[model samples]
Target chain A: MADPFLSIQHVRKSFGATTVVQDFNLDVEPGEFVSFLGPSGCGKTTVLRMVAGFEEPSAGKIVVAGKDITRLKPNQRNVGMVFQAYALFPNLTVAQNIAFGLKVAGMPKADTDRRVAEMLDIIKLPQMGDRYPYQLSGGQQQRVALARAIAPKPKLLLLDEPLSALDAKVRVSLREEIRSIQKKLGITTIFVTHDQEEALSISDRIAVMYGGKAEQVGTPFEIYNRPATKFVANFVGTLNVLEGTVTDAASGKVKVSTQEVSLKGKLNGSKSGDTLSLALRPEAISLGRQPGRDSSLSGEISEVHFLGSVIRVRVGIGGNTVSLDTFNSPATPPPAVGEKAEISFSSGDMLVLH
Target chain B: MKSGRFWAWVVFVLGAAYFFIPLIATVEFSMRMRRGAYSFDAYQIVLGDPRFQATFMYSVIAAIFTIILGVLIVVPAAYWIRLRLPQLRPVVEFITLLPLVIPAIVIVFGYIRMYGSNSPLPFLGSDTGTNSLLVIGYATLALPYMYRAVDTGLRTIDVRTLTEAAQILGAGWGTIITRIILPNVLIAVLSGAFLTFAIVIGEFTMASLLNRPAFGPYLQNIGANRAYEPAALAIIAFVITWGCMSLIQILSRFAPRSSNRPN
Candidate 1:
């Protein structure tokens, strides 16, 4: 590896007494779209700001393109950032906003204009150059902010909950737009958001942060499917941790007994006599299905919710309510309330956590 | 402005009248040049007098200094308090409210005692000293009001987001303060400055104690000596203050809508 495009080496931040980020370390590859996903105050945004040089770490060094930027000022770092509020300069026109960094760096007027036009074209708002940011809608203003940040062709792009402020419909569209633009530019970008869907959809790799630490760092699929910790399992998606014990350990499967049921789940690294607690995702679990010649768990349809495309059915499993989501068009109709439904999921879908 | 709330509207209009009647009376008194004639001759006298000119000039200069200092102190203080030192808020707020607790006379008296003849650090040892001390006093008085304005501005915009964005965009502390933070808080700063100008210009207590040839003392002296001209001067002061405040409102109205935030 020539050098990690951007590397955070065990950075830590504390405000007076409380330590927000502790021993945070990650090496981001070039042209990779990475997201720092976590709940509020999980230090995801704090880490992003540290990378952008807005914050000085209490420990560790931030290296960008082989340069030691641990102590470099934010202005000295060639990073473009989009804020949650968009941070569009109200007094400046869209074009001027896009050209702000170039102008500040003392670029010629013609070149600045050209780069701004290129940015506008890329963000799909070429004609909005003369308009002020206030004249535009929320989505439009964010687009302008995006264009302005990327216009300078920064080495790294930092988006701190850029789409978190938009409405649901707009959030999806803008997030997609941001991903496409990142791909087009191939800028090593760090997107900080608590929205799991947004992170899973856009990021090539995600460092799921918890308690100011990277609980797990992997592809969205890995983080969601093969969660490494209990926190990761609970935080990643709607998970049902059916507390059970390993009654028997076969070749690749372990039969676990819960309070009201006994089911066999694949234990990747578990021995017999060990306590086994596995997570099954709501979407992965199948509901209202025929009993196959496989390990079956007892379930009852306690409640049913009809989402637009899927039916979210909560099943009573071993005195625990496990939500099972199934597609609702032709495959299966949404389960009725108080219906006797048998739920079964593949062993592969079950995540065995130590 | 919902229609069909006529009774509420009536009560609101009455409330507005109740507050504005005294102001109207003052203006009415200023309008009459002679005992019976309604004319702007009072304005002519007020505008024409060199003493009034000097007083207004001093007021403007003092206000400009106070505003600059107040904004300088409050803008970053708001951001720092919000982001870095949140625990220091109550202490800072309490210090800011000191002006409201201590009257202008008492504060100026302290200044005279502390900085007057043969003191440890004589602030009134020279005219320059007196002028600077007066401006500092005014700035301290305006601190609470300016702090509120800046605080409100910070609340409206996402300060953390904006500051980080500016930083990432190659803005140093100086640039961020000048280009980003200051522009965003311009409306609040302007409104505070205008209000401060109005207060300091008409204030009679501090300038009298300090013995500065500023506007407030000039207004007091004029009121005591000249009767008709004093009313005219009062009207002039009212119009100027009103005009400055109105200008602030209009400028804020025309200010770009800062959506720099989520929907």
Candidate 2:
């Protein structure tokens, strides 16, 4: 296997009584974009800060390119960081901002100017060099910040919610821009974000953290479809959990009981009558017109929400709400509120998780 | 509404006049050298005097020394105190405000006893032992105002960003402080320096207690020995202070509209 470009070994951080990060370990390959996905205060940013040398780890070591960089100061680490606030120098023009890192590294004036011009070209803001950060929009400022951070050509780029300051459209577009730029430069990047869609869209792998620990780390598809922990499953996307009990033990199959019917699930160890939770994705459950459906439980339609491209149908199953989504089709009529409906799904969709 | 604004302006002008009347009277009285003969003799004599020049130079040297050392010492202390040692902030801020709380004579007397000759420490050794000690004293006195400017400057910019950005660019603390921080806070430093200069020029108690040659002694000498010259000297000092302040105002206006220097 190729050597890991960045090795974070069992890093931990604590503030007084609370642990911000615990036993966090991740290895990023060269030219890979990995995302730390979590809600606020979940230590995703803390890990990024540690890698950037802004925060020191209480325990463990960080190695970059085979070098132990745990104790090195931020400036000594040869890493670029873009903050959520778009912390651009208001006193410097866009070109000067891009050249700040080069200047700090004592690059010659001619070379600095060349690199700055190249940075502007790469960020696609070549003509806006003379404008100050205050003169630009939020998206423009973020681009300048990105350019400034990447201009030094550091091996690792750490982005902390870099696109969060922009509006929705700009946020999406700039994140795309950032992803393209990362690919173009072939730089190993660690992006910290709370947005699940962004993490799923732009990363080679995502480490979903909870309670200061990485709950799961896998490719975006695996993370979304096969989360390892309940935290990861619930945090990464909307999930509907149903109360159930195992009713079989052999042949790697078990029956999960709801109120009116038993749902089939793949379980190898669980015996009959053992309490468990039935984890199901909203898109996995299919609603139909059949009554007392075959191997499918029936529920009353509680609410129908028109969500533009897809419609959300909330069904009351055994006094618990279970949501299912369908693509917005004029031919596919939504179930009326309080109407009886049967929800069915293939055995592959039923996740026997506790 | 416009008439109310006009009335408010009238009241403000009246209040301003009330404050400047005494200063104007003093200056006019100084000009009436011979009780009817409006002559330039007082200013000429004061200008020609070797003692006045010497005292003025002393004050200038003391002010320059204070500005340099104060910036050197306080900027880092305030920066670190504000950024890193946040818990020690209140105590550090209170220490800087010591001069404003205690009387000047009380503090200067303590200084003389502690640092003057015959004292156990001999910090200053003699009356004329070290003008450097007097500058330290001046910096101590100017701390409250000067530190405020630098502190405010540090606040306006993203201190963490500057440090992190500088570090990522291969800049150590020395480079970050001098090239990044110092230039960004130049206006604040200038404002502090101007205030220090004014305080040092008019500071009578410290210079007198120390028996040091400074502008305050010259003013005192003129006030006691010559009548008209004191008025002229006061006017000169006022003009110098006013000129320095106005220059700062213009420079502050010329400052970038952005709270932080963007790069």
Q: How high is the lDDT of residue A135 in model 2?
A: 82
Model 2 regions more than 4 Å off: A249-265, A289-295, A331-333, B1-10, B34-41, B116-129, B256-263
CAPRI quality of model 1: acceptable
What's the DockQ for every one of the candidates?
0.44, 0.50
- Show pairs that collide, candidate 1: A85-B260, A85-B261
Tell me the tens digit of each residue's lDDT in model 1 across B1-263.
Answer: 46669879989999999988977887778787677788887778878888778878887888888888888888888878976687998999899899999999899888988888699898899988898998899988888888888877777776676676777778767777788777877888888888888878887788888887788888788789876667777767878888988899788875545654322
Measured against the true chain A, the candidates' chain A TM-scores are: 0.91, 0.94
Candidate 1, residue A94: Cα displacement in angstroms equals 2.4
Candidate 2 residue-wise lDDT, B1-263, digit = tens: 99999999999999999989989887788788876777778888888999989889989988998999999998888777866787997888898898899878887888877776777768677545557678878998999989888988787777777767777777888877887777777788889989999999999998888778888987987799877898889889989999999988888865543533432
**DockQ metric, candidate 2:** 0.50
Candidate 2, residues A1-354, lDDT tens digits: the string is 988999999999998888899999999999999999998889999999999988899999999999999999888888988988887766678998898889888899999999999989988898999997778888988888899998889989999999887799999999999999999999999999999999999999999998899999999999988888878888887898887655554544333345434444356567767777767788778887433334466788999999988899998877567899988898867669999988886556666664
Worst 10 residues of 1 chain A by lDDT: A254-263
Error of 2 at A78 (Å): 1.0
